[model samples]
Target chain A: QQQVKQSPQSLIVQKGGISIINCAYENTAFDYFPWYQQFPGKGPALLIAIRPDVSEKKEGRFTISFNKSAKQFSLHIMDSQPGDSATYFCAPYRDNAGNMLTFGGGTRLMVKP
Target chain B: NAGVTQTPKFRVLKTGQSMTLLCAQDMNHEYMYWYRQDPGMGLRLIHYSVGEGTTAKGEVPDGYNVSRLKKQNFLLGLESAAPSQTSVYFCASRSNREGQGALGRANVLTFGAGSRLTVL
Candidate 1:
């Protein structure tokens, strides 16, 4: 049913520019949102996460802006680098049935130098 | 700590073949998970274990089975391999902490490199 939907199947941004990925969820039960970055041949790694209580959370150059009413969240990476070129996934946490996570399709980002 | 590690990083099987994937964690985590990643589909949970001797099914559990006989190891078995079963498998583990307020919450999952499987 696609509980979480992400936009821009692929993104290309210039180095030092801002890279943003957005996601929206249909379930209000979701309280936690996390972003993951995955390199080829590797599993996804936690990048940043935010709870619905906060409208925004920033970690170093990475930031997560969340809107509870809209059920949307976005990840912003400042000063995007070529090394940042990889696949990004946004996932929402809904622990109803069990400790299960619902993930978005994915966004492939390319930061060109 | 070697964190979470999956055995047989790569495997190839034919239809009707059966195999088991082993996942071991050195961190003594209470929760372990098995997920599969496809081309367009992101990571989909197949099975998970909250503790030793307890296992639960995830989003896609058909044609698959899992066991957690020991706290440090989680095994996933495919009774019959099919072409649709081809994907990259990942194992993750997390520990419980206070203020997380529940089991398997507020903890980041440490994932393994991944295991690539091909079914002919």
Candidate 2:
């Protein structure tokens, strides 16, 4: 099984502050990195994703920064709000037939008012 | 559309009891998966099916059995529930159409609200 390491098991940020979560993968074969957000008692939903071809991809207040050489990717949330508080997971996959997506430990984010 | 629906949102079973979790998708997806989410351990795949009448074991498939009799439905069964099996189970589905999305067709998975199961 491929190992996925996520940082900051937990985080706390003030409203309007930036919240960052990191993920490191050991497999270079992975071509797609996606982030999922899960609120309490709810299933995870796709938040954002980035292909290895691009270094960074941003949508609204969320951004995904990828580093091919480093085999790592990070999610940055700018001006994060209390509504953004949730558990985030980094799921990377090879994007090929029969390949299963690997998920990280997850980072719990708490945004204070 | 009820993307994916899981039955028995919450269930409690005795250690030796048996129960099955049903996952139904209305999107006509060909691929379906069953995953168990544990605290601090992330979600681990228990079983997955690429099409009807086919099933494959995943990372933690020890005491779980899965069957895909219909394209839109996947069932997970536990012969005998155990305390270790207490966790949240999630069902997800994806389309088989290629080149449907920019990131690729197999990258996205629409998950169900999840079912909470506990074995006493």
Q: Which one is best on TM-score?
A: 2
Candidate 1 TM-score for chain A: 0.93
| lDDT by residue for model 2 (A19-62), tens | 99999999988877899999999999999988887799999999
What's the C-alpha lDDT at position A18 in model 1? Answer: 98
| Angstrom error at residue A39, model 2 | 0.5
Docking class of 1: acceptable
For each candidate in turn, the TM-score is 0.90, 0.94
Q: Quick one: best DockQ, which candidate?
A: 2
> Candidate 1 — which pairs collide?
none
- The residue-level lDDT of candidate 2 at B37 comes to 94
Off by over 4 Å in 1: A94-98, B99-105
> Model 2 - which docking category?
medium
Q: TM for chain B in all models?
A: 0.93, 0.94
Off by over 4 Å in 2: B100-106
